[model samples]
Target: MYAIVRTGGKQYQVATGDTLRVEKLKGEVGETVELSDVLLVADGENIRVGVPAVEGAKVVAKIVEQGKAKKVLVFKKKKRKGYRVMRGHRQMFTALSIQEIM
Candidate 1:
């Protein structure tokens, strides 16, 4: 079965044993996280969709890792004006292993 879960202002379609990186979340490695905002669930030919979210439907995942993504550089320059700006950023993320959907 597969499920669509919402987290950190994003939605992800996941299935059991699948691993994916999502926006930063609390908890350490090996911690269990229950995602209750399940938007859709599908099993073979059967599908269940939520109004906003499916009641009593949830996805269980394990935090496998947490780290920052690669740095992104932002540069801006104004020709002739001798103005320039440079910045770098690394977004934090959490890796999750989907365990089950219920």
Candidate 2:
């Protein structure tokens, strides 16, 4: 079975054993988290959609790790007056493994 869930102001399509990176979650590695905002679920030929969220529907996950992604460089330059600017950013993300959907 697979499900669509919302967490951290975002939506994701997930199934059992699927690992995904989402906006940084406040937890340590090996922590268990429950996503209650399940919008949709599909099991073979049956599809269930929630008006807001299905009653008793939940997605369980395990936090694999907490890490930052590769740095993204941002640069700005001006031709005439010789102005230059450079910035680098590494976005924080949490890795989660979808364990089960219930």
Please, what is the whole-model Cα lDDT of each candidate in the order they appear?
0.97, 0.94
Candidate 2 residue-wise lDDT, 1-102, digit = tens: 999999879999999999999989888999999989999999999999999987789999999989999999999999997999999999999999999999
lDDT of each residue in 34-66, candidate 1, tens digit only: 999999999999999999999899999999999
Q: What local lDDT score does residue 30 receive in model 1, on the 0 to 100 scale?
A: 99
Cα-based TM-score, every candidate: 0.97, 0.91
Residue pairs with backbone atoms closer than 3 Å in model 2 (clashes): none
- Give lDDT for model 1: 0.97
Give the number of the best model, judged by TM-score: 1
Each model's Cα RMSD:
0.7, 1.3
**TM-score quality measure for candidate 2:** 0.91
Stretches off by above 4 angstroms in model 1 are none
